[model samples]
Every structure is written in structure tokens, then in C-alpha cells.
Target: MRQILLFAALAAVLALLLVSCGGTKDKPVPTEEDAPGKAAYHKISAEEAYEMMISQEIVVVDVRTREEYDGGHIENAVLVPNESIGSEMPETLPDKEATLLIYCRSGRRSKDAAQKLLALGYQSVYDFGGVIDWPYELVKEG
Candidate 1:
């Protein structure tokens, strides 16, 4: 009788655990790829990104507002506001596997934009904060 009670209790506990975990028999365990981390979305210095810009082929994305970008922006940086990263990627940038160097007016917008870009299937996205910290040349629109 004691052995029967022990078996029943163990079975009950096992059933509870399975039900608590969504009750799915074939569900795989979640991994970091299921949710990206900060390191995956690298936050490098402006100088680092600048060196890449000069030395290698990289796409620089500015996540600031149009007015902010129009004020002054790093040369060769394209405007793709954080709010504009919709379900579809910008037509100007269609390569999901491209190495993207992203920035904004400050660090906040760039971080948000980088995550969104990653979620949208951008494989390599780097958030280098704002151009305000960039100790380099800036281009003003006419």
C-alpha cells in the first residue's frame, strides 16, 4: 500500500510539472537566440565605428528624428528612425546579413533601433550611441 501511494504521488508531481510548462510534449527549451542579449547587440565606441567606416565596408544607420539628423550628422550615415523600423526593412537597406553600425541623437534611441533591427532579421547590428559623442566630421544638409 505504501509503495502504491508513493508511485501515485510521484506521478502527480510529474503531471503537474508538465502542465505548468505549457503542457507541450515536443516543445524545445528556449535559448539566447530566442532572446538576444546586450553583447550580441554590440555597443562600441564612436571611434571604433569610425575606424570601421574608414577601413571596411559597413552600413551606418542613424535612428534620430529627421530634424535632429538635419541639424548635423556623421558623413555617410543614413537616416532610419527607430519608429520607422516597421515589419518590413527599409528599401534602401535590404540585406539582412549586412553589418550595420547604428546610432542616434543619444544612446537610447540607437539601442532601441538596434534591437528592432535585430528582431527584423538583421544579423549583424552594432549600436554606437549618438553622433554627438563623435569627435569627427559632420555633414549639414542644405
Candidate 2:
């Protein structure tokens, strides 16, 4: 009976320690919590994304290969190849809280990248479709 009591006491102490370390409700929320593990994805128009780009400090990301990006892409889009987003985020985008605008040659890569970005803890991720659907002028990297 004494041993059981001691084990119960230890368990209670461990539970308290775990609760304390879990995190406080009053603490500042993590950026990743807002958009975690592909649970968040916003589909917006190219025009809307462009407008936001002009108005906000957003990161426009191209989730395609270097060759695909060199062919033609929206001006000022940082390359974060889709295959490179696991364990750690792409070097091009370190801020998990940044409003990320992602795209690719077609909608598929953009969709995949958007989900991966969310999984990597990006707070505000927007998938504005692909360059193929973009009506805006695209510039080729020479």
C-alpha cells in the first residue's frame, strides 16, 4: 500500500510538471498554430494576389524546378522548389508567419506546395493557381 501511494504521488507530480511545460494559455501564440499541417489553404485570384502583393509585404513563391522557373514566371517570385519542403522549410522562406503566395507552372504543384507550406507552419498561405492560368504578363529569366 505504501509503494502504491508513493507511485501515485510520483504520477501526480509528473502530471503537474507536464502541464506546466505544455504551455500557458496567456502565452503568445505560435505562428504555426494558426496554420498547421495542411489544415489551411486559401484559393484566391491572380488579380487579388497581385493586389495584395502591391499592398502587403507578401512572399510570392514559385514551387517549380529551376528550369521551369527560368522559362517564365511572375516577376519577383522566389523559387522554393516543391521537392525541397520537408523537415526544414525552404531557405528562400524562413518566416513561418509571412503571408505566402505560391504558384507553379500548373495548379498541381501549387496545390502540393501550399499544403506542404501549411504543414511546415506557414501562417497565411494563399494558392493563386498556376502561371498557366495567370493572365498577367510573365517575364523569363535570361
Candidate 3:
């Protein structure tokens, strides 16, 4: 009977330890974080993206390959390949607060990059469709 009681006490202590070390469940996930400083996902059209670019200091991100980017892209968009974006913040996008305008060959990769950026806690991510749909003049890297 004494041994059983001791085993029960040990089991209780172990359970308490597990609960303490399991981490908190209240913390928001990257994409769901919407507090003042936290990031949120926002979708915008190509025209709206252009307007924001002209009116604001937004960073245009081309989530395409170097070859794809050299072919043609927005005036000053930086290259951050979709495959490169993972758990870590991208090198080209240092400011998590900067308004990120994402684009790719078509609408598909842009959406993917946007989701990844959101998951990485990047605020104000705007996906502007594809370069093929962009009405503005595209500049090819010389």
C-alpha cells in the first residue's frame, strides 16, 4: 500500500512537470497574430497595388527565379524567390513592418509567397497577380 501511494505521488509530480514544460497554448500563431505590431494578410489588385506603390513607400517583391526576374519585372521590385521563403524572414525583406507587394509569373506563386510571408510575421502583404497581367511597363535587367 505504501509503495502504491509513493508511485501515485511520483505520477502526479511527473504530470505537473509535463504540463509546465509543454509551453503555453494561448500564444497566437504567426498567421493569426493580429495585435497592433503583429502582421496580417491583405490581398490587393494590381491597380490598387500600383496606387499604393506610387502613394506609399512599399517594397515590391518579385517571388520568382533570378532568370524569371531578369526577364521582366516591376520597376524596382526585389527578387525573393518563392522557394527561398521558409521559416526565416527573407534577406531582402529586412523590415517586417514594410508593406510587401508580392508578384510572380502568374497569380499562383504570388499567393503562395504571400501566405509564407504572412506565416513569417510580415505585415501588410499584398499580392498583385502576375507580371503578364501587369498593365504597367516592365523593365528587363540589362
Candidate 4:
């Protein structure tokens, strides 16, 4: 009886350990002041982006092809294709401390661009998904 009780206790302890070590929880959204080398971008909704656009002076970046951009894009959004981003900072975007709002056609490239910008030390980067999700008016190229 004593041996059986010891084995049961050991099994219970092992199960608890396994449960505790199973997986990690989702990380919280990073802020502008998050430590260097950490994720420095924030994922915001289109509504939130619109609110910010109305309330602040932000640099809206369209991380899509020029062809797609010419079709239609957010007003005042600059074209900086994800493929064009290199080791050096983009000339159009000179201020690393400025608030950057990024978007792509379907949210994939925007995320990639936002991460790259953050890695490049651009503080206050916000990924507001894609332009398809943007309900606001778009400006077409002349």
C-alpha cells in the first residue's frame, strides 16, 4: 500500500510538471518604449488607425507594389514596397522617431514591413492591416 501511494504521488507530480511546461502564453502587445531588439510594432484596427489619423500627424506607408498603389491608396500614404526596403532607411521616411502607420493589400506585407521597420529602429510603428480593410476613402492616381 505504501509503495502504491508513492507511485501515485510521483505520477501526479509528473502530470503537474508536464502541464506547467506544456506551452507558453501569448505575448502582450509591445509598446513604443519596449526594449531594443524586441517587437516594437503595434497591431491596430482600421477604426483605431482612422482615429489616430484624425488626431495626430502620422506617416502612412503603403507597403504594396506601385501598380497596386496607383490603382488606389489612402490619402497622403507614401509608397514603400516591402521588397524595396533595404539595409538603409528609406529616403522618404527620414525621421526614425515619427509615428508610422503601415498597410498592404491583404495585411501580409504590411506585417512584414512593420516588423522590418521596427527592426530598423523606427519607433512608433503601427500595423493597421491592409487597405482592403480600410473603410475610408482612397485617393486614385491621376
Of the candidates shown, which would achieve the greatest TM-score relative to the real structure? 4
Q: Give me the displacement of residue 23 in model 4, in angstroms.
A: 18
Sliding window of 10 residues with minimal summed lDDT for model 4: 23-32
- Stretches of candidate 2 above 4 Å error? 1-39
TM-score pick, better of 1 and 4 = 4
Per-residue accuracy of model 4 over 56-96 as CA lDDT, tens digit each: 99999999999999999999999999999978899989999
> Which residue segments of model 3 deviate by more than 4 Å?
1-38
Q: Please list the C-alpha lDDT of all candidates, in the order they appear.
A: 0.87, 0.87, 0.88, 0.91
> Would you estimate the TM-scores of all the predictions?
0.72, 0.71, 0.73, 0.75
Per-residue lDDT of candidate 1, residues 1-142 (tens digit): 9999999999999999988876876678876765654236788999999899989889999888899899999888889888898888887678988889999977999999898888788888999998879899999898
Full-model lDDT, candidate 4: 0.91
Better structure of 2 and 3 per lDDT? 3
Clashing pairs in 2: none
* Top model number, lDDT: 4
TM-score, model 2 to reference: 0.71
